[model samples]
Target: MRTGIRQTDVLIVGAGPTGLALGIDLARHGVDALVVERGGTLTPGSRGKGLQPRTMEVYEDLGVLDEILAAGGPYPVGMIWQDGRQAGEHRMFDPAEDGEEGSRFTGPWMVPQWRNQEILRARLEQLGGSLSFGREVTGIEQDADGVTAHFATGEPVRARYAVAADGGRSAVRRALNIGMTGETVDPDPLLVADVRIAGLERTWWHVFPPAGEGAGFLALCPLAGTEDFQLVAQFPDGTDLEPLLTLDGVRKVVADRTHLAAEAVTEVGWSSNFRPRAALADRFREGRVFLAGDAAHVHSPAGGQGLNTSVQDAYNLGWKLGAVLGGRAPESLLDTYEEERRPNAAAMLGLSTAIHRDEARRGAKTRQLGLNYRESSLSEETRPAPGEIRAGDRMPDLTVDGVRLFDRLRGPEWAVVELEDGVFLVRPDGYVGWAGDSTEGLEGYRARVGA
Candidate 1:
């Protein structure tokens, strides 16, 4: 490695929600990290528009939930249309019960992917983290000590640990020779575009089923906090629709699929086409390089789990990386990142695939609140008989001493919750690390985890 090369404690590739959220977590931990993006500006699109309840809690911990809620709104009811007339209403998400106790955020919040990234970037910058845009990682080299990321332009970055949050087509993951193995979730390619329409109402998510056999479905969802309506249309397998990303092409699709004319689409902001697929990397880590978000796992957008899962991936790795990099914990702690996240990502991938195939519904599973790490090596259940909430479960938000549980678990610290009967220790990422009738091994666990 060349002397005077740019250096940081952690090098995060990509500036999407995953990388930005991880950057925020590390920055708050006083870790020196740098985020590098291949593009000069943030990617533009309403790609992943739904934030699950678990992710809302993550945002709150990162100190950006207020901004996220202020910038987005609840998903509107789906309005079915037939013969150019109102047919009926369809609920896109499962209705939330009044005052759900386990979580404060009951339902998924609707926020465009671009807006979400912007908010995360803002929060990261506020924490004094640095992001280098237009810096593409062409290759990466790692050894026993650290990793070096070579760029297409500008100086290469040397960091104690490198994270590949650079999307599914991660250059660093590829350079490390990591293999992703999975099947295509769907054969039919889907076109998604953000556009401003003149005639569509923003009140409901407009849904148009297939007109006839071999036809496809079309959905125009009003993106909250913006004038753009996210247009999603399915096409036959092997359909060549790359040329349809143009403004005219989008307008033609909208006019042909619905009652609206081509002129109804006033402006097309961003568009892309993709076949829904679910894939997980063979391993989440290779030497000093760790893969996070889409770099490690890819999922269909059906259950809206891709972005949220990816963000949580970063959350899971952030604290571990911070601990090791800050010299507070042993390097062995980093291994748990792959241990805990890979299985969760695999499960979420199955859920997304199931939803895409219509074999499952977007209900409790899609909300991501039930996901746990009870099977993880770090989880310890010392109680004789645990209640509904056990070790490795997500710590439910409750008022203890008039302070919300989430309030105590907000920062990068282990929280010990004292309930009426037993005691529970919550990890920084909000999972119960230990549970027992008393604090029998709490000190040992705390010393081991560097809490």
Candidate 2:
């Protein structure tokens, strides 16, 4: 390493779920990567608390599923309150059927965003990955060779590739002059805080609907595996939000909306205010630098899609980067990162916006199990008669030769499985990349993928 410059195969900007998860994935593949964060520590608060099933699967592959399961629990039933009395029970998400075969997790899990990042960072470090805090990326420049990222306080970092996992107002994306197109899902700003309430039960998500005109709805959902409850209140449009971020202001809002008194709030840990919005970057790539997570797309929190989509963005990019940097795949293989992820991100943005507006419910669609890359240029389906599982679809967990399928697909390698005498090439990300009755096209596909 030079005096003021560091070198790595991949430079990941931002240490949120996206960047940390990408670091873990790349590390498991034996790739030398560095994750840099602008902040001094992992983010706090119960932001983006829900982990969808697809993301749970991704965690399993990244070797952190056990920690995630132990640190979080399932979403509780919603308890509706009226005039300080229990009005009725409301189900936040549509009831899902029993977990289907090959599906281990069918519902969303609730874990505070802070805890989730802790687990990801721990796993990344355990895998020999490197992360440095307080490394603020001021701007980044990329050429045909590599990317050079200049920070505010340290020597610049140079890498063969760079990714912006920064948030919606991504500084890296702006540095590349990428544009975001989006709309506000709601005019009213929402107040979300992590606080401890004296008498609130932890078994149910408490809901307080508006009692009269000019009043807003309030919901206090207990953050699983923690003592604090996440308070969410919708304010009238154009209302000033500066006061609501304080402890007294939160107590006042709780007292006014629900039956709770101002004295019931014991402690306030973190708070934030934001108007719900959904947006996507015009492009996911610029030269050797690419955008993932919030930098690539921003979603309303209604359907818990933001964080999950962001993690999946990292998962989708990780294997491709490993393949290219390791000299296993063609440089052009990197193009598929944007081609496969951008459209999916746009669709998720629409789904999140719809759910925020009550046009869609959190159920089958929000689970994200059915999301795939069937149309990607890398997806090759040469079978004369495709079965229930096709190329580009998520490879379901199954048992073969008394061994688990996902266990076989684990780690950083492509897998080939024979089902009904048909050959299936599973990508490292757990998607079926190619399917055929024989090895007719497997070698050609492998050559292209550097598998």
Clashing pairs in model 2, backbone N/Cα/C closer than 3 A: none
lDDT for each residue of candidate 2 in 1-451, tens digit (9 for 90 to 100): 3466788999999999999999999998889999999999998898999999899999998999999999999999999999999999998887666656356888999999999999999999999999999988888887778899999998899999999998998999999999999998999899999999998889999999988988789999999999999999999999998898999999999989988889999889999999999899999999999999999998999989999999989999999999988889999999999999999999999999999988988988788888999999999999888998899999888888899888888888999999984799999999999999998889989987898
Q: Which digits, one per residue and each the tens of the lDDT, describe model 1 over residues 1-451?
A: 5586898999999999999999999998899999999999998899999999999999999999999999999999999999899899999778767447489788899999999999999999999999999999988988888988889999888999999999999998899999999999999999999999997889999999999888899999999999999999999999999999999999889888899999999999999999999999999999998999999999999989999999999999999988887888889999899999999999999999998998988888888989999999789888888888888999988888888778777789888898975899988999999898999999898888776
RMSD (CA, Å), candidate 1 to true, equals: 1.1
Q: lDDT score, residue 437, model 2? A: 94
Predictions: Cα RMSD each: 1.1, 1.2
Report the Cα lDDT for residue 344, model 1: 95
